[model samples]
Target: MGHGTENGVGRRAVLRGGLAASGALLVPATVAAPALALSGRPTATSGVQSGDVTATGGLVWVRSDRPARMVVETSATGSFRNARRWTGPLVGPDTDFTGVTRLHGLPPGEQIHYRVLLADPHDPRRTGEPVTGTFRTTPQSRRSGVRFVWSGDLAGQGWGINPDIGGYRIFDAMGALDPDFFLCSGDNIYADGPIAATQALPDGSAYRNVTTVEKSKVAETLAEFRGNFRYNLLDGNLRRFNAQVPSIIQWDDHEVRNNWYPGEVIAASDPRYTEKSVDVLATRARRAFSEYFPVSTLRPASDGRVNRVLRQGPLLDVFVLDMRTYRNANSPDDQAHDPQGILGREQLEWLKRELARSRAVWKVIAADMPIGLVVPDTTEGLPNIEAVAQGDPGAPLGRELQIAELLRFVKHRRITGTVWLTADVHHTSAQHYQPSRAAFTDFEPFWEFVSGPLNAGAFPASALDGTFGPERVFVKAPTASNVSPAEGYQFFGEVDIDGHSGDLTVRLREQDGSVLFTKVLRPGLVGQ
Candidate 1:
């Protein structure tokens, strides 16, 4: 049942030593190269990644340069000797040679070592080199602490994979923290920004990107959108990080275009997009996103909804929302009705029900867009196309009406330890909403933390809507265009929840892993 020889070692000992059972058999530098060289087979270009982990199972993802068969081997021990083999779907041109395999029937709260093997499409006997990855399942007991990281906006605003500086080095910084998993808040890729081989910096120096023909133009077709995902895998750091940290990914506007609504028509003046209809382009983008990431819940449903709940043992419950799919057109004059809001009636009801039923200590709303931020689109002129807000700082209007209702429900239900984590504004900030300071103060006090632009242009802060009485506790943003990671403004957020005390610590970190701000919250401490 196992492919490799077994080593006599316990899983706990292996994890405590920070080494896998397979580590003893392979050299770190030559693992991928020597194995493929000996077999004369095409190796995986994007390495291996594991994600969407539960107590019993998880998903593993890989991308090959050519058509191949996806095979995965998992073991309780690191040596992977006597590991259970799971044959996955075909990795073919239909999915841009990327595929994911689900691993099931594993023990909870234990380290699972896995290797990804790609077999020849025609000859199953011939296999490529194996890429190794490890992930720990969610703890079954309520006594174990949980930690995870989150961020958004990858490769945006003309920022691309730069070989000279090591592409997206911030991922490396995040990976070093060794969290349980990574939650990609949104904007996994920038389909609207074209990447060039060389980008001139504001300092008059040239910043180089490892560009491809598909990335040179704005993504339109399905192939182009898939290429955007493949392009980010070119970086060795990202590939290594993906292998180590399993991801829970969600999408935002840049995954298709900038602040695009569902049924909007592309303006002819924008030369980059030739697809007149934005929905058509979003369909292509959504398919590519599903194929590339290991999130199993991203499957296309009949109603076109992608909202789901991710429960990590008894510690945390993450409700991933689909903000883009059912949203109305961005307009200030829109009515304050539930059907015409950001989260439609159906989704809002589901969120409330899930929050009320959740037994986890912390209830996290993984919103792609911020609540109070004033995001306006003036391309069509006049009162401005507002995505989530009507820009009225005083009262709830347009999309804010739905959000206000949700907040009120939380207060009525007396839900404690509920926090919001979002990334879309391409900056990092900590906001505290107090009933006393807000215009409409029916809900209990809560916190919202924003961090983003994994590698993108940084912008100024957005004005907050006063409907929730949000106060800016902390803020950090770059004053320049297309800021690089070396500038040290790029940010990510980490949440660590202690099982014993039920205390939650939220830390906002810079690109270099330095903490920008830290907040600690205890259970039943709402409005404190």
Candidate 2:
């Protein structure tokens, strides 16, 4: 997969055919070859990705199999005539051989081409054939229009990359739309869900997974967690998608363990794990998460928090929330005086302040879990609640109190053009919250869109808690639980904000790129 193109265009340039193209987001290269044994050229098999992109800058990532110097070069076009060079880190064992470089001074709304080279530390001349990528910066003008795709829950419930089905075909479908970016709404990796080589499908076919050592079991150690991130790069479709789309990533429960929170210990009865402390595992997982994704705020030297506002020009400002990191333990969720609920106190305040300060046409809140979805905890059984809602319909209780407080604040501030997008439930649905129909009538009406499972098991839509009076306008879910990808029901959502008219359209699409549902909202409206 090294420099398959002659004139210096990326080998993946043929991805115009999208899913049909044989190009990979990452193709396995021989990264561990002896340094001085042969030609001594360093290799980067993990491909390349860019994320946390803004109008002026972005971050690029790559992994080397051996000790090598990371070097990045960028160009306005594919031609490397007047490229700018940036010397990156010396990627080695300390960070698991992965490195990220920040790219600055990029022009807004224009496609910037780049290439990554892994060079021998001693000699710059000894370098691997470059891996190339391209992405457009966020537009500075409101009239430029903006569009992005979102989904979550990858390789969960025992599903992994299936080479028989083109290895994450959903990415190819999404990449075809040419979204400005991708909002990966958490559950980016399933540290607790181990994948097998092959399994029989109910439809008389077999699900053949592209297996890797890291994806074989629950990740506990730091290396295993890093492997969990690298495991997804084995899929050519996903690798291609990463090369094309810059992602705004956040993590949910699956990245560390199923339904995990701080200070929680795995029950001893679950013998699959020896590491009982979820905190220890989470510390390791968080480092790996920071290393893997290119979040501007979560860089290695930074404070490493997921809650930040990404200003996408004048049209959109995405408030990425980390509901997993800072939260009270999952329980019956009925505490009447709980302020440190799902979002904790600090992140909740930050979100509220950011929402009030956003001057963009739309303020899209990206929540890892749905607000009103009744996501119950199956671990250790009983009445433990996993997400925001706790099934009580009467008054705001437990984590619902935090959400109610935020909604009330929004109402009092007269904040308009707000919408919520999430995807932890593995189904596609839309809800319109209205005060007139509500038990809690303090907040103004808004829309929440849920879509996902991207390449994982599909479950029935979770029961909606009536705390915010969210009416399910549309829902598409499987009747059975944990439906395999072979049986269909995989989904992703698209948001297209028209520049001239300022009408935001949301489309829920399936794995095959079929639009399942659509909702349109105006910019200056109190409600849709």
Candidate 3:
């Protein structure tokens, strides 16, 4: 089968079988746009992105409208007159025509410009218009400062691509910040939330979604799951933001369904996916996620989980946790001794070892869900199960035990400058967890900053569990659902690390580019 040719196979078959012909080939520079235009296939519709940046390299991503041989040219200048060329993986039907190029040997702490060129996969003689992007590699010196933004929840609760309003304009606002990278905390897509072309607004106005056949229903098949990732790219603002700002992306429950776990079965109440197993759905979702995001962390480990660490220079180390992959089913009766608590044994051990071994001045835990927040899973007509916690006001219980153990380990290891950043709560808050205020005081004090719902419903603040000693320092939440970004509650967090002093500054900002709260902590003053 030729690349871009859709054989009569179903979506799942295409996903599984299309990778058989992924042979890497070089393209000639003589390839021109006119020749590709004759093929009548759309080129790069989703725009281009660069991500997973390290001191010496980064990953560049692009999605072609058809199967194509991907090429990336990098230069220090915006003009690619003397650029270095690199070949990306073959983009075929297996990955929904999306591919990532690993750009290595880049100069650290310097702005690097790149252009993505797609040629005919079979011919390699016809080319499409090149998409341009720029990113800076991590600084090799610990004396260089670092800045990045973090947020989550895209197209959730029926808030999807609105072409009329320029599709997720918050991204444009975030882009203006000019951060080095974006840490997508979780809920990158809502495969469970089907979007209609037109939705009725509260004031009798109509909100329009740039809908496709794939996004009109809950995602089940591989193609539908891939469509969930494609749906956001329809937004020009998101595309523009992605081009300039690299991303460190992760996923939470909504990537498959709200609060779904490994063994849960789809219920009949959800007409779109009745009687389906969530694990099967997650398999499809995970593949689509890995295909779309540029992060190598999406590649599963030997144990089939996506938990890893990213250390940028000696200033900061990010421990990205995979809370969804190894979690037990949500239930109120989850016990402290349960082996299937959120992080799983293997991942938790890896995290501890990574943290203790790190020499960076700052250790930021990129948690998909907050430690103390009460996340209730009311799916499948089941009683409200504690997805991450049981909301107990006393000692650690259930999943809390796992978190407590991790915290105690950190304390015992004397891992200073350790902080937590999370997003699943749909609000922005600054939380201070002090041992003196906790029922269990074995752990050292730390700060947890919560911000999210890049384009989704605004929710009220979740109640904190007393087990971990979380005290809300500052909170910005909405009382209603489906709140538009225009209302200005949509949030993203920013972190800036000073190289010379090793001071970290955290800022929570609103969708309108206004700062809601700011805090600066020096190296030795973490718990204070």
Candidate 4:
């Protein structure tokens, strides 16, 4: 998680007035449940729920306590008077006892209520306590806007459950924003370092926690990946949020192994990566990613791979990139001038084409790494490369490559209203990189913002320090000019686009939802 601008949920004005008025305008009544957590197991609630309804449809998720069939209901109320229903049996170890049913064929511009009914196998007369929640579909085109939560690096070292506290806070804050969806900017789990075996599925439970680093082995196996996911979802607050909002997710290093590059090993720099081995990891990661996330994967990668994009609506188009499965190791310090390719040639071509054809009011590239922070210069005056290497380098590499691409793409195509967003630096910062008369006078101005960890190991004091370092080198911007904070920590990225005036409002927030900073980027300012 890196800093783009110090900020919080400071866009309340925009949220209240103008095109941003889709602030839960349709969601009327709240459910009557006390939001209780089940005892003695991670399956706190009997079922699962997901929200942030869209124009077309939303999602409903649940997990059975035992082998069972469930009938999910979507209605305008608790009574099944006129509800939309989906019935299916929970199957396989693949879902880890959970089932996510995409509820389709709903009308737009209305608030919908939903719940799950565990059909009793024996009597068939008894139905388990119904779990209910509500969501508001996107308003008319002119009234719809886009908002999403972005953060990364949620692994912690010593504290048992302290790290997840920040993430819970983030969810509450995001609930206020009422975004159509939430995004996982990567590093969703810290299965790296020595604690590779600690991730697990607790006894008789649907969820688990990274109790000890000793057991959280880097997810090298399928079960390990599943357990890593279970550990994060086990948190009560996280579970509640996930049940309430359908999350659109993508993967970064920690999801597999930290700082992983294509066809290469990080430790020994060995080039012994096998297609079978790579596919094994990819398959496991995608399984866990798909099982736990609400995203719909329709256009699977052409090679029978897993890459896909979600077109939420005309307001936003999210292109979820698969940089890990294909990317080469970040360009080493020696090759900073000629960075090792981050986006493999094929993926790069696909991404450029996607951008070129997007017609949404806003195009959101859900990246899991910082795409603008100049790493080498940021670490220049620091302890040394050795010190910087102590943290993941994939983030800085991502930022570097994204910056290069954004500048070239916007200028070359005369594209307007493109925003770059990323997470993994563990702190918040925002930057508006525009072509300067003295710098690149012919290029268009673009903006990139970075958000820090939602929950993770405590960042070093040096990260917050204000000294010339390799990490600080990329702070050059429309505001900071040439100054970069030597260090900072714990933040997330948020952008509010006004459908009324075509203006984009961005913010970087701390754990408590305090706005550390803010910036406004106008579509008219591009190429200025």
Candidate 5:
């Protein structure tokens, strides 16, 4: 009863499961080298495209623009003399012409460079240029200093300019800082259709997906997910950034469907198509996610397949939560129940045990939604309460209840050196919730930082300020000018952990390397 590769196919067996069902329509195999285009033909995309690198190995990603087997090389230099290599056919449409070669057996702490070659007939040169990246092995537990990036919600649906601007800016800033790994909060794409459609941004101002009115559900399918990922990979800045740093990614509502909770459909928000089941949609999204992402599956029978967690050094341990898949979105009886739970019984118990055994300096829970924000109405000046779209009286209440449960659990456990990172609510901010009781007195304080929309939506300062401004009790002093209503920027967060004192320094950084805000917290900061 061992496990299999991504498609759940045994490494020793010859059969394929999952997306392998669509193998009939895949690209036909060709010779190893690149074929020549006519005199004026454009160059096909090229290089040693790699992803999800860890201390031991990385998933080397590449594809042939034309049908051909690919030869991938990994080295510590541009020339790659003593490089480790992998060869395989760029198979089926399942990978969208891409091949994910698992590069194994390399020395740790060494900077590695890599490239891909299509040795076929047309053009015998490397498909993509020699792309270089650096990776370090997971450090020993006693090691103290470590740096990493946390971000999510890059689902810019309409008006492409926002994501383009934000993506470029974040990469520009990240290139300079060069953290060890990148963490996503969630909602990476606004793929609004079912399990087989494509997501396209319109020409004008609308940023939300037009799914409320669209007929086809194909946009949210595996094809669309793959397409969205391909589009994301196609971004020069995103690709360049990926080429340089290994990423730890998690999905949010937009990555599947908006506000998608377990046992629900997109139409669940409206009463019109309540009977429609989204189980198939979820399956497809999961399939696409596994094909494109490097996440480890925690479930026993995740649609009959399993995934494992990715680890780095002693400085960081990420328990990436698949919050959208297994938990109930709203309370079973009442949507606005005072203590509506989110992590559900199973995950809540699992998390408690995981936290209890962690030895890393930073144990980051990469949640897709904020566990700290009082969603409904903590204070009135917030846009959600004041501008409730008229009849939405229970607006913020639902979110408030969810946060209460998470805080209660953390307080009860007296959890220390723990931080919750989330997305969903587009604006990024750090909130510290203080417990009101003695059972949780020792761990009465916790910090929740939401980093998102890497290149997705723009945060309206007026909106965020209204929400977080008035209810400022026990709030840490602002590190930069309070984001004003008229001027604000799309941004991401960088977290650097100081192992010496168990202090975590959080920085709210704009895409262009400017610091929007900064804050530092400690395990002892709470209950003081």
Candidate 6:
């Protein structure tokens, strides 16, 4: 019980100065700090994260540059020995000074070692520096084998955070693939893209960015969408890949604009918003995306629903899908009998009773769009339909009739290790679907893959809606369209799941930790 010696500073020298002020040795910025963190003792310099991890529990984000007093403690080592605390809250700017803090029972596949101090909300022992990190829970033994990594668009189009190409360094190649959870299958943030301090490439060089002023515009209020999630936590390799990865987040439509739905109305040929009601900018981008990620279905009197089901043990469960908040309204989607399509209708019957009560032998759906591709939402050029295939090849119309009734209820409830995984159309592919290349052949042949735009802007590969008869086998986009990330199509995807051969293997990486495609899948399969 001794995190002792605060002001005298020596509890392993405040754990080696909070593990060198939150590891990955700081070297970048896309910050939005209105200054003010000069020692009234409550800092948290935007780092120290952890999220929906499970098999006991997790969730430990942080923010505090001003109205502090978060606590978080946990410890299974890292000299934080005998740790175990929680005590958070009072983060200010009404949560733009974030703060998540959940952590529970813990100890189900060990290795936690957390930290995060902040104090001084009127002197909580006047704390200040302390920021460590670690994660690795989720393993109620199934012979214990599982790895994770998934990605999504980030800093899109006019890509932000560049620090001469190290900010968001593909999260240091996805935190050196030490995966166990990272499924951020959605444009984590791009709030209608607008980051410019220079991005002029057409082979004429220049790409700078590390800009601010709430990303130089286009994220309608709520403090510019909480400064677009504090500008990707001023990327120190995304705060050391969010202090060693644990995320499982989901959210699409540039987190609030590009292709937004639900009573949509910001179209004056796009005026970068005067809050032109896309439901008041998606209720201020879902309250700054529920105060910046740490989703367990986003609490705080819940209703920030990102459609849950992470589950990760008995060999995986994922299912994330909130395909842009219960869709329906970007249409050219030929409706036949739309059931509020695009996963609306109680999230498509709670993803069909949680994929028939998954016992987890894979299941992974996690899609934030990408069901037989298509995706076109042209906006005043009119022919809409953003996601869930509406370039229809017959049968299943609009939002492909809720993915053709959840792939005909997982091929009539035989739900055998279903696979899907996604990342909006920004390149990287692999499809398989198959009902023998037909239209609506009641699901069963599966495998979706797709990677990402982790460092954003890399399109050119989306057009495959033969209504559930996909088959692209593999593709690597970027011949044209948005391309930049220094012109090298960025991406991420990894899955591994074998604990005694339940084989799930999906590696489709790139952005330097190359491994373009690798499929495997044979865990109670229905399609080889």
Q: Which wins on lDDT, candidate 3 or candidate 5?
A: 3
Write model 5 residue lDDT over 323-370, tens digit each, in one string. 665555432223455342555556656666777677665678777765
The TM-score values for the models, in the order shown, are 0.90, 0.94, 0.90, 0.71, 0.70, 0.37
Off by over 4 Å in 2: 1-39
Q: Residue 375 in model 6: shift from native, Å? A: 5.0
Q: What is the lDDT of candidate 5?
A: 0.50
Instruction: Compute the lDDT for candidate 1.
Output: 0.78
Count backbone overlaps in model 6: 0
Native-to-model Cα distance after best TM-score fit, residue 380 in candidate 2, in Å: 1.4
Worst window of 10 by summed lDDT in candidate 5:
1-10
- Number of clashes recorded per candidate: 4, 2, 0, 53, 36, 0
Best-fitting candidate, measured by TM-score? 2
Instruction: Report how far off residue 217 is in candidate 1 (Å).
Output: 0.9
TM-score: the better of candidates 2 and 4 = 2
**Tens digits of per-residue lDDT for model 3 on 239-332?**
8788778888888888888878789887766676753899899999999998888877654342445577877888988888989888877778
Tens digit of per-residue lDDT, candidate 1, span 88-142: 8777667777888888899998888888899886788988878888888999987
The stretch of ten residues in a row with the least summed lDDT in candidate 1 is 1-10
User: Candidate 2 on 79-177: residue-level lDDT in tens?
Assistant: 767999989999877777889999998889888888899999988888998888878899999887999999998988878887667768899899888
* Candidate 3: clashing residue pairs, number: 0
**Given candidate 6, what's the lDDT at residue 3?**
5
TM-score of 2: 0.94
Residue 188, model 2: Cα distance from true site in angstroms: 1.0
Model 2 alpha-carbon miss at residue 123, Å: 0.5
Write the number of the candidate with greater lDDT, choosing between 5 and 6. 6
Judging by TM-score, tell me the better candidate of 1 and 5.
1
